[model samples]
Target: MNRIGAHLLAGVFRGFGTNAKVIETYEGLDLGKEFTSGKECFPCIVTLGDILLFMKKERERLGNRFNPENYIYFMPESDGPCRFGMYNKYHRIVLDSLPGLDKVKIATLSSEDAYSLSGLIEKEKIQDFRKAAWLSIVTGDILDRLLWRIRPYEREEGMTDRFIDEAMERMTESFSKHSSGKDLSCILNDLVEIVCEAKKIIDPHIPKKPLIGVVGEIYVRTHLKSNQDTIRTLENYGAEAINASIAEWINYTTYDQVR
Candidate 1:
C-alpha cells in the first residue's frame, strides 16, 4: 500500500480495538526475492520481504518473548486471475517453511464478499468496521490527490510534501479517535479544512502544466520506489500527474461480486 493509505488503514484498525501498523517496505526486497521464484509479481515479493524482515527483527529483539502465535498478518485478496488473489496462500507457504514464523496467522479480507468481516471480526461490529474502513480508504485517496494537485503548483519547493505529511498525521489521529463512534462527520469536516489549507499552498501566478493521467497496476503506479518516483518525475518535467485511487479497486471488486 502507499504510505498514507497504509497508515490511515492502520488507524482504522486501531479505532476498532485492533493494534495494526504498516511495516517498513522495499527495504526487505532482497529477502522477499530470495524466498520466491522471480516469476512472482513485484508487489507480492516486496510485501513478502517486508513481513519477513519485520518478523526477523522482532524475533531478534524479543528473543524468548517472541510469540508468532500472537500476531496476525493482514493481507487482503481479490478473486480473479491477478496473482494478488494468491498472495496470502503463497505467503503462507513461505511462512510455514520458516522455522519460527510458521505459527503466525495470516488474516485475509476477500473481495468475494466485498471484504466482509463476518468471520474475522465480531458479528455485531462488522457493519461499523466495514464502514469505517471504507471511509478511511476514501480519506487516504483524498490525501494522495491533495498532494499531487498542490505539489506541482506549490508556492515553495518541498512545502507541499511537508504540509501533506502534517495533514496525514492529523487525519490518522482523527480516524483513530472518531472511527469507533461509526460517525465520520467529524473526520469529513477535518478533511475539508485540510483541503482548504492545502489549496492555499498553491501559487496563483504559476500557470498550470500539462496534465498527465497515470494508470497501471495499482502497486507500481502508487508505490514510489516501484515506479521509481514517476509522479515526481512528471512534475519535474513540468506536468501534473494523477494516479488511480486505491478505493477504485475496492469498489470494482464489490461490483464484480454482485454481478
Candidate 2:
C-alpha cells in the first residue's frame, strides 16, 4: 500500500499544479445507461469510477515507488445524504473485482480525521489545501469550458481528453512554485488570462449554438453516466452544454443546511 499511497500524494500534488492527468473511461457507458434508467442513477458514482480508473493507471506507471508487491489508494469520504459516504466501500468492491488487483488497499479520508494522509500533508504545509483547491477549481472550469466548446469539431473521439491532459500539465507547472495566498491569487489571474486567450483562439472555429444548462443532483451533473452523457449528447446535437459547478452543489447541500 505504500507505493499506492506515495502515488496518491504525488498525484494530488501534481493535480494541484497541472502535471496531473484525468482520463475518462466509463463516461460513454455511464451516459448511455443513465439515459434509459433515469432512476437509480448516480453521477458521483461515475466520477468515482473515473477517479478509480485514473488511480489504477497511475499505480501501474509508478510501480514500486514505495513498495512493489502492495499498493495503497485514498478517496475522500463524506457524511450526510450526499451518497458520498458509501463511495469508499463501493470503490473497494470495484477495485477488488478487477483482475490482479485484489490486494490493492483503499483508504477514505474523513473530514474529521486530522491524522489522514491528506491531513498530514495539509498540516505539514498549511498552504497546500488552499493552493490545491484553487488549482482544482480553475482546472475543472477550463476543462468544462473546453469540453463544451470543442465537442462539435473534435476530430478525434477522445481529443478533449488529450487536450485536458496537456492543459493540466501546463497549468500544474505554471503554479507549482507558488503555494502562498498571494501566489494562489496570481494563479487565478493567470488562469483567467489563459482562458480568455483560449476563447479567442476557439471562437472562430466553434459555430454559434444554443446552450443548455444541466442542473440537479450533484453526482448526476458531474458524472457523465448519471446524466445520460448530457454534455456530449448536447454537443452532438449542436447544443453547447454548461454543467453547474460541484461546489454549488456542496454549498446547496451542506453550507445552506448549516446556515
Candidate 3:
C-alpha cells in the first residue's frame, strides 16, 4: 500500500473520530503465507498477513481486554474482473477460523457504486467524509510524486527521506484538523507549503538520469517489499522512476461507473 495515502486516509478517519491507523505491512507476510494455499495473488496474501499480525499484536497488548467488536478491518473491494472482489469474503473465512477473531468486523467499499460510503458512516456525514477522503488521497499522490522527484537528486543522502517523514507528520496533523470542515483551502495551503519545502532538497547541479515509468498491479507497484523497492532500485542504477498514483485507480473506477 502507498504509505502516504494510507497514513493520510487514516488521518482523515481520525478527523471524524474513527481512530484509524495504518497497519504495518510485509512484517506479517509469513502469517499470510501460512494461511493461504499459495493460490491467491501476492497482494492478498501480504495484506491478510498484515491484518492478522496486527490483531495478534493487539491481542497481546490488551492481554484479556481485547474486544474484537471494538475494531473494524477495513478492506475495500472492486466489482471489476480482478479477483479483488473475493478477497473480503476469503479473508472473512480466514478470520472466522481463528479463535476469538470471528467477532472482528470487516468493512468494505465497492467500486460497483463508485465506493459509496452509504452504510459505512452516517448519512449526514457521508458527503463530507468522501470529500475529505478525496482531498487526502490527492495530497498523498502529490507528496509521493514530490518524494520521487527530489529523492533521486537529494543533496545529502537520507535527507529527502527524513524531510518526507517530517512532512508526512505535518500533513497528517493538518488533515485531522481541517478535514471535517467544508472548505478544503487550509489543507491545500499546507500541502503547497510542504511541496515547496521539498523542492529545496533537490540539488540542481546533479545531471538528470533516464526516466523510467513503472506500471503494474497496484499492490506490487506501490508496496516496496512486493516490488523490492523497484523505483528506488532503479534510481540506484542511474535512473529516475515514477510509479502510477493510487488516485489514478480511484478516478478510473469513477469513470467506469459513469460510462
Clashing pairs in 1: none
lDDT (tens digit, per residue) of candidate 3 on 1-259: 6888889999998998788999899999999999999999989999899999999999999998999889899999999689988888889999999999999999988989888876777789889999999888988888889989998999999998999889889999999888888998999999889888888899999999899999999888988899988998899999888989999999999999999
Question: After aligning candidate 3 to the native by TM-score, how far in Å is the CA of 125 from where it should be?
Answer: 0.8
Worst 10 residues of 3 by lDDT: 114-123
Instruction: Please write out the lDDT profile of model 2 over residues 122-179, one tens digit for every residue.
Output: 4656456544543455456655666567655555567665665565555555555444
Residue pairs with backbone overlap in model 3: none
Instruction: Tell me the whole-model lDDT of each prediction, alpha carbons only.
Output: 0.90, 0.53, 0.91
For residue 241, model 2's alpha carbon misses the true position, in angstroms, by: 1.9
Candidate structures ordered by TM-score, highest first: 3, 1, 2
CA shift of 46, model 2, Å: 5.3
The total number of steric clashes, by the backbone 3 Å criterion, in model 1 comes to: 0
Candidate 3, superposed: residue stretches over 4 Å from native: none
